[model samples]
Target chain A: MPTTDADTTFRFLGCSEIQEILGKQAVDERQLAELLEEVPLDSVYYHTHSYFLRSRFIERTYPNDFAQWVAQQLQDHVLAERLSVVDPFDFQSLEALREELISLIDDHLSGMRTVPRATFGTPFYFNRSRILEVPTGIEVQTLREFRDAISDVDSSAIYFHVFEAHLRLQREENDFSAWFRGSLKLPDLADRMKALNPYLGSLERLRSNMLTMCDEQLAKSGRG
Target chain B: MIRELEQYREVAPKGTIDFLYRLSDLVQDKRFLHISAVRYGGGMVEILRRIVPIMKAMGIEARWEVIAGTQEFTDVTRRITDGLQGREETITNEMYQTYLDVNARNAKVLNLDADLVFVHDPQPAALVDHRKGGKWVWRCHLDAGLPHRPVWSLFRRHVLKYDAAVFSLPGFAQRLPIPKFLLYPSIDPLTEKNRELSRAEITQVLDQFGIARGKPILLQVASFDRFKDQIGTIRAYRMAKKHHHCQLVLAGSGVAHDPEGEAVLAEVQQAAENDPDIHILQLPPEADREINALQRGATIVVQKALKEGFGVSVSEAMWKGKPVIGGTAGGVSTQIVDEATGFIVHSVEGAAFRIRYLLSNPSVMSRMGAMAKEHVRRNFLITRHLSDYFTILKILSSE
Candidate 1:
């Protein structure tokens, strides 16, 4: 499809979404390979894992590996040149390095099909059933159908609204299971979501799980 | 000095002046000595200039003292200021020694003997070490919650010696051993900076600055500090300009106590180059009436500081009945009630969004401004601040 202002192709696709989309027959394998190659190694690692010794592993120990991976896999000579100038002994936080990598990836994928990236705020998973408001008794056939249902709504806005609502509810009442059940009118879906332990997981984990659930449901519907 | 407390009674709420009088009577013969770094420029000095005189008028012996320091000392303290405001800066041992030496000298020269010695900011905080007698209170005007560790450790040593500590907001207060007091900074409604300016005066000042009255004005008035994030303000203006036809005015002056102001100002000027709509006004220190006029004339006022210390300019603009878009830092959150008086923004994009939203909704902007002025009147005026100080004095004296 030709890109327009309303296009979500330019927006960041979570790691799980990228994996699911890449598995589909519609996405070109060569393009998928190139996209995966261009994505930062550290981002991929952080995206897949739920927990790690961040300070010791990512920040204090991984700049050299990151630089080498960028040079070898991404093949961005300009970024490689910039990374070569950085002293390994110099203290750069993992958060700063991750941001730099994300910026590089974002620049590379500015006009690409789907940008595999991580973002802040609550992911669409927890709020998807609430925001999309699929009519009662109409089962979502596939993930593509779900994506098409709310493509016009900005994900960031949904994330902020859900996050704000979550914060507001947290101050008054700790349990969101009841609120989610009441708001969405889907007790089973709310139970499944509450089982994901939204409060215990990081935002990235929550997003990944949400996107993974969508992929699973779509695959089960014989759409993959 | 505005001599009579009754003069403010006309502008303040009923019984406010009477309440201050009562508080003053409680501490009738007490003496106070306030020591800070600079005598001119910055909010602390401007506040003390009006507050000390009013305090004296209330039959209390109040004195203001400015500490002496060299260029090197000021530069070190400026870095320390940045460190305290959550920036990571390495303060060498020599800088630490020089700071203590300057404070030691000031302690010897300045009068430390008083019923209460109120030391402001990190500059003269170490003066508590050289205290001969009397209860000492450290009035911290900066955000010290997430300070650079080494610099904070040095200040913590001196800060712990004070009898009490005063912070503008509860969030700015650290885990101190002393009794902590929350005192929001205030604006003197009768001063040239906050008093109502006539339309003619506003237009004259706007004309002097060559600002156009045809378009809406988005203004940010703050010193050229990195933490003030002037560059971020410029970026936000650029983003907002793409959607709305408005002019941006960034007007401020660097104080003598801060050494990084010139560099930051130059960076801001460079960022604002070739943009005629962005007026970078480096006003003189005595431009109080001009500032008043600018605030009065602004369509929306913004203080997008990455880190702030109460930001009395936010209060000053709010007092002039202008809606403010302040950052979520320091005491700014205490002044701006989000979605009511103003919006608390987190990023440049957020600020741009707010500016665009406000420009598109003139009625909402006006309503917000009205609410902002009322909020400032009730919570941020000098009368409330004076009452709080008296309440603090009563507590300190009894202790």
Candidate 2:
């Protein structure tokens, strides 16, 4: 997934999969055609997954037509019903709708046995060992849990963790791969994780991808 | 000490001195402690030196203490000072921690117990957070209308802890949960900087500096700070000189607590190069008598500061009976009444026009000078300042 410009005018898509779906093929054919007819392709993505796009999508496609299509064509009845209840005109903010959609996708993906976790471009792997060791009382399963865990960590601790990881990595070419291998002690996982560039992913997308990878790895190990 | 203030009756109105006496009678024997960043240099110190002595005279047991800090602490505070004066600057978390650490250390060693404790400026503002049973008033001496956001947010956290906050002008204050008072800073008319100077004494001081009596002088007396806009003063002087043949004198000195003074002084020097008529004199810290002579010898005094905190120099010049063209920045506008006491200008061009107009009409200048002197006498004298403090003290004690 490509990152949007960091300017405040550009709204970052919380989920990279959602961004990819929006960019490549609209989830609903009729809704996509109707939207394309009403707004220019460039304006539809004023700045990828912008508030304008979210508002327009909610206003033009929600409830009757797009929700039905999502239920029938996309086979996401739960998400379709959720979208049906959200009144775009009366909604509090664009972020509320975006979060609702992202959460729905996150819930659906975590339910699957196999998950692809690619954040920005980096890959993350999780197993039963990591999930059971979270300091927080909450169980680690979905993207939201991963994000919450990261947020729960103190800023100084995060700084030191990243610093220590980077320092050990410096002995061998000073890259994320080396750090993951040397500091995190995940030699087999280093090369795959190193491929991802955090600058190319929104913060939300990166965390979500990491969570998905953790879940998949745990499932593969038969300990999830 | 109270008898010494009686000498002011010869220069001030009878009601002013009597008011001080009455207020002092009400607050007699009350203990007050003033905490500031430095003991010498700057207007806060200058005012405290005179005011503390007189407060003691009035039967108020007043004491003054200076906070200790390292050079790094002073550097951080200098940036904060500039930020409060509407300059764009970044104050980091490290800087904030250092400032609080210094204040906390001082709080540990200093005796803060009194009927009232006055914490002057941002340097010692955090002392209120560590106060031990006293009415703490945060005396902010800078323009606080639009401080740089980060710096103001940090300062506001500590300032909100005070019982009350004091500002030089009503506009220089921030909206706070606590009660605030507008108290204008004053110049000591009896100090060496504002006392009567003999004709021979003034002439000799000017001659020592090689400032010839040939040209009419345009003077600015302030520290070489960016907010003071000494460069802007020079620019206005240059523009005025195109119309009038008057020479400009920029005389100022720096304080030890402010780290940016030397850089600003160097900038002023670079801007003043190649101008023979422009005199940039970096006076010593103790050049109060010389500053008095310079202001007394000037045809017109200008304080074209970009942002000011009740510029005492404006009051100092007005007290000497000189027509002042002051910047419409902070409390300077409060002292300078456009076309009445003195003219308030917003830009260099506006200041130049006023400077030229004042020099062209000597009678108008003389009349304005008289008005300026009367204005200072009525409002900006140390006696009035002392009386205001007494009034606040009375209210605080009653509460």
Candidate 2 colliding pairs:
A121-A196, A122-A196, A126-A214
- How large an RMSD does model 2 have? 27.7
Compared with the true structure, the alpha-carbon lDDT of candidate 2 equals 0.65
Report every candidate's CA lDDT.
Answer: 0.65, 0.65
List fnat, each candidate. Answer: 0.00, 0.00
Query: What CAPRI class is candidate 1?
Result: incorrect
Per-residue CA lDDT of model 2 for A1-224, tens digit only, reads: 01112221111111100111111224342333334334333222222223221121012223333344455345556656765664432323334444444455455555755432221111110000000001112222222343345443322122222222232112222233444355445555555554443322333344445455546545655646
DockQ of each candidate, alpha-carbon based:
0.01, 0.01
- Assess chain B of each prediction and give its TM-score: 0.87, 0.89
In candidate 1, how many Å is residue A223 off?
Answer: 82
DockQ for model 1 equals 0.01
Give the residue spans of candidate 1 off by over 4 A.
A1-224, B69-79, B86-109, B238-243, B254-273
Model 1 chain B poorest ten-residue lDDT run: B13-22
Candidate 1 lDDT by residue in tens digits, B186-297: 8888878888888999999999999999999999988778888989999998999999999999998854566688888888989988688999898888889989999999
